[model samples]
Every structure is written in structure tokens, then in C-alpha cells.
Target chain A: MHEMALAEELLKISDEAAASAGAEEVLRVGVGVGWLLQVERQSLAFYLEALRRDYPRLEHAVFELDEEAVRVRCRVCGEETEQAGWGFACGACGDRDVEVVAGDRLEVRDMEVRTDDV
Target chain B: MCETQGEGHQHRHLEVHRHAMEANDQVAARLRRGFAARGILVLNLISAPGSGKTALLERTLEQLRPLRVSVLVGDVETERDAERLRRCGVPVAQIVTAGTCHLEAGMVESHLAEVDQRELDVLIVENVGNLVCPSGFDLGEDLKVVLVSTTEGEDKPLKYPAIFHRAELALLTKADLAPHLDFDREELLRNIQAVHPGMKVLEVSAKTGLGLDLWLDWIRAKVGEKQSLHV
Candidate 1:
């Protein structure tokens, strides 16, 4: 649902970053999505691919997603564990009071740009 | 084709950081800072459409009429909720998101400017009734209060754990109907606990005023805490 908006932002960033770097064309964009965000990767890719058609420089550019797992640290045992979906219980100590340490990140990590200059 | 030693048509990977929700989160952070400066405590209320959010707000507003309080109601369509809150004799703003399911931080920040800061002690944002999308968004509120009624079943916490997990307070609304319905009170609390350990839970009935005092006291305490920080 909100993936369309996110995809739009991703394309805008790619175009701006490419232009600023003196690149004639964008090759690829790397996007990082944490497990916490409920983004459909397929839908995001579809939207990015479909929307990039409007940008000439991004015609061949593709957006790639690298999703990170949700990680939490148990408050009682101080053990960090990867959470599966909504489960936050610590595997070792079985403590429910786990604090989320990682995940929930949705950002553009890097982009590959090609310049026409020789 | 001769390639220069330092310069040529080469592929380069540049670190371009563009946060997906950076736009929204930035605005929310700004709003948080602004509220902190003004010594105002903001609360974002999220729940299903019929989870008694409006009812609880109405009751809370009426009881807190002596104090300065305002509300911003978010809906897909209609000024109905805003109009109802106006009867409480407090500043009320209606944010119609058209077809948008959730209210973003930009929306809250823009509408908040319309509110009179001098007369407002606390701001309560009633998010568009949904359990999923709103959980991911930060609306510059001091607390994210999630409401779930007994009729919705205890499994709601398990079904939509994200909302409960992110919420600072989980409110069980419509306790007046608990007698007529076979709503497992203990199970619901347990489910909420499982999702978010140490999260605060309160049972409030707008009709019966059950736990209204405690809710108001909590708000007062929050307001006092905010004001104390300013001092």
C-alpha cells in the first residue's frame, strides 16, 4: 500500500544522486528494508520498474532490496536474538522482555552510476 | 578506446542514503522537539474503527475539560468525529486523508499549526481506524496508545502484534459490555504482555467511567512530567 510512495522516493533519490554525481545514467540502486516494515518486495520492485519508465536516465536502472532480520536483545538475560515475525521471546532464557536492537530500517544504502565521459 | 589513468567512463558505487520514511520521520522529530519546547504532551490514539476510540476520547475530554486539551481526528472521510469532539468545548481539527488509510506525521504537523498553542495543554491525535499501517508511522506523540475492545476478541493482540508491540499503552475499551459478552479478560492481557512485555495496560469504559480517573491521572502525570522537564 505505502510501497508506491516508498518506491517513488527511491526513484527520486536515484535520479538526484545520479545527476549530482555527474553520471549520465543510473545502473542500479540498492535499497535496505528491515523486517519490521511491512513492505511487499515484489510490489515495490514493480512500482519502481514501472515508475522509472518516466525517467530517461533510469530507464535501465533497477532497484534491489536487501531485507534485514528483526533482532532484539532480551532485557532479563541480555541475549540478542533474531525475531521471527512478531515473536520476540529470547530463545536461550525464554524471557519476553526483549528490546528491539536492529531492524525497522528502510533506506537507500548505495547506488551504481555510470558516466558517459571518457 | 584509451582510458585515462584517473578518469574514464567507469562504474562507481556511491553511498546515497535516502531513508524511505525519512520525510515523515523528520517531520515527526521536528514536531516532537516543538512539543517539548512548548511543554505539551501529545498522544496518538490508534485502534480499529469501532474500538471505542472516539467514545473514550469524548469521555476523557469531558472529564479533562478543566484542563486545556485539544483533539485532531483523522478519518478517510467526514467531519463527524470532529463535530462530536467540539461539544466538549475544546479545540478540534478534522484531518480528512481522502483515501489514505493512515495519517502521516506531515499531516499531524500541518494541522497542529492551526491549533492555538497558548490554550492547549495536551494534544490527542485519533489516528484513522486501522491496526497495521499506523503502527509504522510516528506522529510526534509522547505516547502511542492502542485501544482494543473486548468484543474484538483477545486474539487481536496476537493477530496484530505490531501495534501492541509498538504501543506504550494498551487500553481495553468498552468494559461495560464485558458482562454481556464472553470476552476473556485475562487472555487478552496475557496476549498483550506476550507481544510487548512490561507495556502498560488499562481497562476503561467510556459509558461507565470505569478507569477514567486513572486515565486522567495518567494524562496529568504525563503533563506534569513534561512541564517539570521544562523547569
Candidate 2:
């Protein structure tokens, strides 16, 4: 459902970056998906492939996506958990007061472009 | 030919760090600024479908006397919700998202133009009935209130932690039916606290009028707090 919309956004961003750089071809685009966003990689990849037909510039671009672990800090015991679970309690003191340190964003991190000056 | 062609191209790497949700967040920030300038308090209500979001709002309009409030209702495809709220004698607008699961900030910014912002003290947005998709979006609301019905089970918050984690307050609607169903609220409270950690909970029945005063008082206090900031 919304995965298509998110995939379109990622494709648009990746293609636009390559287009603005005046690259003749795009090789790879790296993306980071946070745990909280609940975006499935399989659906996202499928949508990207299905939507990229419109963006000919990215016809063969490699969309490299990786997940970012949810990191949180416990308010009571001062311990940080790199991959927080659904329970959302402190890993140390069992306190529920935790603040998210990362894993709250989906971003296009980098891209590799090629210029064929023929 | 491969060697010659490969040599003709130059490979370059670009470091482009940009959030995919930046566009929606930008529009939300704009809406936040506009609401603040007008001294308006906006609340976005998120809940599962049929969890009584509209019913609670209907009661809100009926009970919160003298507070000028407007509603922006989001649904998949219907004008019926807006029509229902309009009967309460308040300006109501429907955001028909077609097939979209959630309402975006840009959609809200555009649809809200139809209503007069200057005349509003509070604007309640009943988000599309969804516990999942709506949590990822920000519609410039002063706070997000999540509604969970007693029938939904004790681990509703545990199952959908994202929405609960993001919400400021949780409303246990359909409270009048709790006893018959043998719903254990203590377990529900523990599950909610497990994820949200001290999030305020209110039990109310739109039909029976239980705990409506507490709900209204919370709104009144929030409205007063927002007004004092602009003053």
C-alpha cells in the first residue's frame, strides 16, 4: 500500500540525484531503513523495481538497502540498548522510560554515478 | 570493445544523506507554525477502525461547551463522517484519502484551507482508522491521542507499539461495555505502560457519558496551556 509511495519517493530521490549530477548512468544507490518505520525490504524492493520503469535512468541501478538497528537509552539505569524490542522496557533496570537514540529515519545515504564522456 | 567502453566512463561517488520523509515533515512544520501563530491547539487522533474515534469526537463537540473547535476527518473513501460531525454544529471537513491508509501533512494543509483557521481554538483531526500507518506521519498536531476500545484486548498497545510509543495520551473508549466482556484493564494498563511508560489513560463511553468530564478537563487544560504561550 504505502510501500509503493515510499518506494516512489526513494526512486525519485535517487534518480534526481543522478540526473542533477549530469551522470550518464547510475550504478548503485544506498539506503538505510530504520526499524520503527516498519517498511519491509521485500515489498520496497518489489515496488522499486515496478516503479523504476518510469525512471529509465535508473533502469539497472542497484538499490542497496540496509536496516538500522533501533537504539535507545534507559532513563532509570542509564544503559543503552542497540536493538530495542517491542517490550520497550529498560534492558538493565526493567524501567519503561527509554529515549530513542536512532532508528527513526529512512534515508538515501549515497549513490555511485558514472559519466560516459563519449 | 568492453575495455575501451569501460575506460571511457568515469565513476564518481556522491554522499547524499537525505531522509525520505523530509517532504512530509517540512509541510508538517509549516502547519505547526501556522497553528501556533493563530494560537490554535491541534490534536491528531489515531486508532484502529471502529474503535470509536468519531464517536468520542462527537461527544467532545457535544460536551465541550464554549470552546470553538473544528474537525478534519480522514477516511479511506466517505463523506459520511464529515456529515455526522457537521450535525454537531461545528465546521467539519473530510479528507478522502481514496485508497491511502494514512493522511499526510500536505493533504491536511491543503484541505484545511476550506475552513477558517482564525476562528478556531482547537482543531481535532480524526486520522484514518489505522493503528499502523498513521504513526509514521506528523500532521502538525499539538499532540496525538490514541483510542483503544475495551474489546480490542489487553495487548493492543503491545501489538502496535509504534503508535502507542508516539502518542501522548491513550483513551480507552467503549468503557461502558468493559464489565460484560470481562476485560482486564489492569493488564491493559500494564501493557500500555510497558511501551509508553506512564502515558495518561482515560476511560470513556460516548454513549453512557462515563469519564467525559476528565477527558474534557484534559482538553481544557491543554487549551489553556497553549493560549498562555501565545499571550
Candidate 2: give the clashing pairs: none
Per-candidate count of clashing residue pairs (backbone under 3 Å): 0, 0
Residue lDDT tens for model 2, B1-231: 012245778787878888888888999999999999989999999999999988889999988879999999999998999999999999999999999999999999999987799899999999999998889888999999999999999989988899998999999999999989979999999999877777999999998999999999999999999999978
**Against the true structure, what is model 1's DockQ?**
0.61
The CAPRI category of model 1 is medium
Encode model 1's per-residue lDDT on A4-109: one tens digit a residue.
7778878887888889888888878888888787777898898898888877889998678999889889899899988876757886798887877778877888
Which lDDT value does model 2 have at B154? 94
Q: How many backbone clashes does candidate 1 have?
A: 0
By TM-score, who's the top model here?
2
Tens digit per residue, CA lDDT, model 1, B60-112: 99888677998999999999999999998889999999988889999998798
